[model samples]
Target: MSGKPKLHYFNGRGRMEPIRWLLAAAGVEFEESYLEKKEDLTKLQKDGSLLFQQVPMVEIDGMKLVQTRAIANYIATKIDMYVEGMFDLNELLMMYVIQPADKKEEYFANMMDKAENRYFPAFEKVLKDHGKDFLVGNQLSRADVQLLEVILMAEEYNPSILAKFPLLQSFKARISNIPTIKKFLQPGSQRKPRTTEEDVARAMKIFRS
Candidate 1:
């Protein structure tokens, strides 16, 4: 891309949020065009901006990209296996976030069980076995960013979730302190807040309209 990539999505975090995390981790500054109303999305469709009539689209490198995975893959160029696993964890978290209030308790319990037992342990072992600051290599990669994002998300659900996994606790501390990511973590950065019930209602109105 000649200029900074321009992202199209709602104001709140959704599938696009991870793309923001990845770009920030890579130290890239980008622009966003939030769809504040249904007409905003309709106009994009009318103009053929969306190939599949979806948001979370990006304008970059003389191309319009859609599909969350495709956008992340293009940004990452080559995704590590560990990065893919971390994305799976992110999806599980997103599912819980968007669940109906009545269903959230059961969903949260199940998600936490899988995260603590299945997901967190696997990445903890990766960090421990490698004995490095990053998961896949000596340097940072999408895997590291993805892991950090998920760790924060998991912690938002349970502040003490990482207590059992000391290595992951250290990993979170280490990756989050990186200068680029650290900047993104600061207030007034492009990073979005945790999804709220109002966000879900707003999104429902936008898409259903």
Candidate 2:
């Protein structure tokens, strides 16, 4: 609210990544408190900082927001439908990212097939049908920010994923070039890098233990 929002989550991106994306896209600077160890989470729970005793929480507007959808809604008041769709895509990608190393290849293939055939085409059509740079109205919205995040995640797996979709390619280019988003995309920015095997293992140890 008055001061910069503080985010509480793991160092790597999970649900909080999209919230970071939205805030960055809006040009809002925030701080992060990463849960690096089990005690870090246990402390929060003991202190009652977590309403649901779970994370992806945000301290904004003098309130502690939990639940990914609720936090996203608070950040981006409108544009639920598109945000939900993009988040659905994000979850699919997350599933692949955290898969076992031996099973990653198969999961990656299945996830790509769904993304290319089902998800990407739907968003591509929304852009083409509207003939606008953003998925919703002429200006950027939460939908646009979330979609851009999803597109980048997809491209990390396949650099040429957008080759078949010219509109999405242009959309990604347009969104990435925005001054705030451009800054966030830079190296060393708060934006987390693609999750790695070590990151996944660490997260599992923290949450599953």
Candidate 3:
């Protein structure tokens, strides 16, 4: 909060959406350094800025941070949106959805299957057990926003993914109605989630240089 924080990420919502949502929810002012070209990220990697050679690196509080979860957690902590025992609960809950024996493609297929058959049911139960207002507590937490992103991503792949989970569907609608989230949802200046083969080739060239 001392100075303007700079968020460097691919021009996509993949891992950066949660971080962006937390920032917007907190009303924090920050700058985005979009690495639209993968080679730009490769340049950072060569220049020693991208320690892990990954997108969504955050520069804040005079320090550079790596990893999506770490970046999101840091922002949530700063904004007081992080509730103990609430964040990352979905990850833990979905741990068994993808088995260790499955290959990448099989793991992804199983993940989609389990999301519908197993995860949504569990989430619906949790929603009923708790309240429909929020996932963690009475107030909205970063975890809820993260869940929203996950649901949206799933829905994008399969429009009817949430048709069975009434409670979860309701929950998605509830969060989407938030003023800040509503504004964020507007198809305006946000970058689309994509990367071209040429971008990948450029990244490889930089890597081999």
Candidate 4:
């Protein structure tokens, strides 16, 4: 809040993961100031600090940025961490990752009792149909990181859902094991929930059978 950016969140991995990773990848210093779910937004309202009157806010050098993608992209730009062609690739993958969840919310949430549409085959097609690694290809872009998280989420939450897209499987496997990504895999960096080894092990057990 003083000089570098400070993140506000509900302690669970929400919109802040990618933003935090981007900041870390860029080697920028940030504060991960977590908040409880019941924490009052009144303090933010009183101070007129929450720009969009929302949680998951990021305060950078005294400026408040609201919404996850906005903050994530802004920080990526600030640190020049976005890979070449990252903007375009992010747009494509963003649509791929979000569209199905919006279109089939009841099927994804109510029927399944889950918060994600990870089972949607169309979602996997986004990457598979494109037939490219690293979202845009080769270089480690923000889109790569974001898609990597989504792939892990889909596999963990829905199970066997991503296998339909063998291309996606290969692509994800290659990037997930990238030296840079592997190096960043230290406990010091932020992580997406489904990315845990335990979840992956569970999924692999099911897939093996």
lDDT of 1 by residue, 1-209 (tens): 47899999999888999899999999889999988889989999999999999888999999999998899999985656787788888889887867887999999999999899999999989888999988876998888888899999988999999989999988888888999999999999999999887898888777885
Residue range with the least summed lDDT across 10 consecutive positions in model 4: 111-120
lDDT score, candidate 4, position 53: 68
**Best-fitting candidate, measured by TM-score?**
2
Candidate 2 to truth, TM: 0.96
**lDDT of every predicted structure (CA atoms):** 0.89, 0.89, 0.66, 0.55
Residue lDDT tens for model 3, 99-176: 354454565666678668765676677788986587766888776777776677666556898888888888999988
Task: Note each model's CA RMSD in angstroms.
Answer: 1.3, 1.2, 5.5, 10.5
lDDT of 1 at 97: 63
lDDT of 4 by residue, 1-209 (tens): 25777877644454566776666555566776655323345566568877766667888866788887677767643323333233333333333333354565544444233222433343355566656564454566666665566555545545775545676677677866766566556665555443343443443333232
Candidate 3 global CA lDDT score: 0.66
The TM-score obtained by model 4 is 0.59
Q: Higher TM-score: candidate 3 or 4?
A: 3
Q: Give every collision pair in model 4.
A: none
Candidate 4: stretches off by over 4 Å? 1-4, 25-29, 37-40, 77-132, 183-189, 192-209
TM-score of 3: 0.73
